[model samples]
Structure formats: C-alpha cells, structure tokens
Target: MGAAGQPWSYIQRFPTEAGVPRTYELPVAAFQPVGMRMDPAPQAPAALDPSIITEVSVFILDKQQGPFAITITGIDAES
Candidate 1:
C-alpha cells in the first residue's frame, strides 16, 4: 500500500520461479522504505500511516526493457 503525502515508498520482494504462480503474505510492518530524506531541513516520518494509504500497486522491479503483463486477481487488507 502506498500512502498519500509520503516521502518514502514501502516494498517487499519475494522470490519467484518463471511461469509459476504463488501466493505471498507480506506483512504491513515488514514493508521497508526504499528512500529517505538526508537534508539538513526538518525530517519526515519514516513510518507509513495506514490511515492515509490511497493506493496499492504491483509491478516488476527488474530493470529490463521489454513488454510485461501482470494480472492481479484480488487484494485484501485485514486489520
């Protein structure tokens, strides 16, 4: 989940085998931030606020130039 007005993006990477479908359970707390502010100015919160989460996205992180297709069957969030 991506939160609004956040400086950092959270991510959890899972291992996969080609052409094999798998179900992954990623804990919200386990999501690590990729970027952080290092300026001398006031700092932003490192944690993500669940209340402000506006979207969730799935994509391939591999830096390759090619056409790719990913099908998301469903997304469920439990409190």
Candidate 2:
C-alpha cells in the first residue's frame, strides 16, 4: 500500500566556488496518480541559473510501484 503523507522533496547540491550543481530525486509517494488526493506537490529549487546547468537527466522506475530519479550536471560559479 502507498504511504499516507505526500511524497518528500529531494534536493542535493554540489557546492563549487563559481556555482554549485544540484540534483533532485522525487519518489512515487510524492504524487497521487488520479482520483485521489495528493498532499503537497514536491517543490524544486526556486530560481536556478541556466548557465550553470550543463546537463539534466530524469529516470523513472516502475516495478512494484513508481520511483523517479533526477540528475543535474553543471559547473558551479566557484569552479
């Protein structure tokens, strides 16, 4: 069975002198498919400088349930 609470927001930061790269992973528990009440939607970072972002990838795993993984590649200002 699914969890009760809404999915949690995942955030990771790669600190750099110039600018830090960041990645976020949101689990399936975060959202309700449909015909169901979804707690609070996961929130991503506010405004992120596009220049620092070199690449971004999103992956979804559907086995017993649903799981999502997101990876972001960038160069921090410090670098």
For model 2, the superposed segments whose C-alpha errors exceed 4 Å read: 1-45, 61-79
TM-score, per-candidate, Cα-based? 0.68, 0.21
Clashes of each: 0, 10
Worst 10 residues of 1 by lDDT: 36-45
* lDDT by residue (tens digit), candidate 1, 1-62: 56676665666677666677777888777766655432322243555566777878665777
In model 1, pairs of residues that clash are: none
lDDT of each: 0.64, 0.33
Tens digit of lDDT per residue, candidate 2, span 1-79? 1223423332232222324344434332332232123233335233333343443333232334544343446423332
